[model samples]
Target: MCNTFPAVSQVDTGASQHRIESAAALGTLVSSTASYLTVLLSSPAHASASESLSRHHAQVLWDLADIDARTAGLLARILQPFLSIGILLMIIRIVLSWYPQIPGDKLPWSVVVKPTEPVLGPTRRVIQPVGGVDISPIIWVALLSFINEILLGPQGILNLLQRKIDIS
Candidate 1:
């Protein structure tokens, strides 16, 4: 007996097309990232960080933060206070958070909010607040403080580099 039903054509779900597109996008992303890393690993003068740092006998602090010793002192001075100021702003934001009635757009509050929002906005999305309270400000404070201690503290990376520059 012959079948009476119409033969349905296979549907093109575009899975193969999607996969090809996805693979191409991923390859492009990888290539882009590799190029970026290549530049970052290399110095402003196009020298490797390891290669540049090797010239110095003082081997305590070696990182991507400073590739040239000429700028180490300036970097330390600027970065130390930058981190401190970040922590201070976060603290002020934390205090501002305590007073919910204060409008964020007003003077003083706006000054604090404008600077800290860029940081806190992304942080809140990544880490949800505990209980009913928002803790991003506090978290940022801790992060800045920790960074300050790590890169600018006594025996810190940049501080050591700064010392190295001072000695030479």
Candidate 2:
């Protein structure tokens, strides 16, 4: 007698694939939402000093002296990644500039010395580089990170967003 076994492969399990696709879509949505919000929050016109103050006033009166928790959470989620990426980019730029050797003339305007009238005789004391010491990049990285983490991190954005939403 010949006995035939049932094929287990014929059983369809489409739910797993659907779940994975749903998860991926959700991730994309969250990332995009965060990015859009970050751009809005960081915009010069939107986050201006005057605008921020107005927003703070609205939040105090309208939101019952409290900010919306959901908005705050979203801002935190978006800003953390953005600030981290900015730090990473700054680090990369610093590293890249170290090897190519940027020209002294091409140095940022802030670091460049301005020409001034000579006080003694017909000569001026031109600023000269005495040695090879470029600490600006290090200082920049430290300052940027400090600003992002301390000043512009969770508290700042949340307060700003609260003010904005409250005003509008």
Candidate 3:
């Protein structure tokens, strides 16, 4: 039997190299995220912030890295949709608050207060009367926006977590 070796074309060789590099990078990211999560979970005070927030940030990065889409990542993915729901709730509340003529006890509008009342109740007490106008919705919107920035913004917690992971 004669042994023969097939010639490797430049394109094939380049593609293989690219795949190898991508795998290496992915491996590094996975390890880094795992290590960081371990430390963060083991020591609650390691990161100075709300425990849940810290966990969420870790989860976000872990998901983005696509190392594993298991528990943490799955939970982290909920934050975006949760925030979207929150914004929608706030908008409905704001609209209803704006037009007193609209009967809120009716269907559709009835559900708006259920989720938003808890938040608006406390906020209304804090914000002084704006010429008899309830500005609590605006305040809530601002607060939610701020939260979104902190948790989901480009230079937000995810980046911070990634940097820390990269450093270690």
Model 1: CA > 4 A from native? 1-69, 165-168
Listed in order, each prediction's TM-score against the native is: 0.59, 0.33, 0.52
Ranking by TM-score: 1, 3, 2
Best by TM-score: 1
Considering TM-score, which of the candidate structures 2 and 3 is the better prediction for this target?
A: 3
Give the distance in Å from residue 120's predicted Cα in candidate 3 to where it truly belongs.
0.4
Task: Please identify model 3 stretches exceeding 4 Å from their true place.
Answer: 1-75, 159-168
Considering every candidate listed, which one attains the maximal lDDT? 1
Which candidate order results from sorting by lDDT in descending order? 1, 3, 2
What lDDT tens digits, residue by residue, belong to model 3 across residues 61-138? Answer: 433443222322333466778877888889878778778888777887878877888888888888865987888988
RMSD of each: 20.8, 20.5, 14.0
What would the per-residue lDDT of candidate 1 be over residues 1-168, giving only the tens digit for each residue?
Answer: 111111100111232211112333334434544454465466465445555344321221211332344455566777877888898899999888878899999997898899889889999999997986789999988888888888778978767755554222
State the TM-score for model 3.
Answer: 0.52
* Runs of candidate 2 exceeding 4 Å displacement: 1-65, 101-136, 151-168
lDDT of each: 0.60, 0.42, 0.58
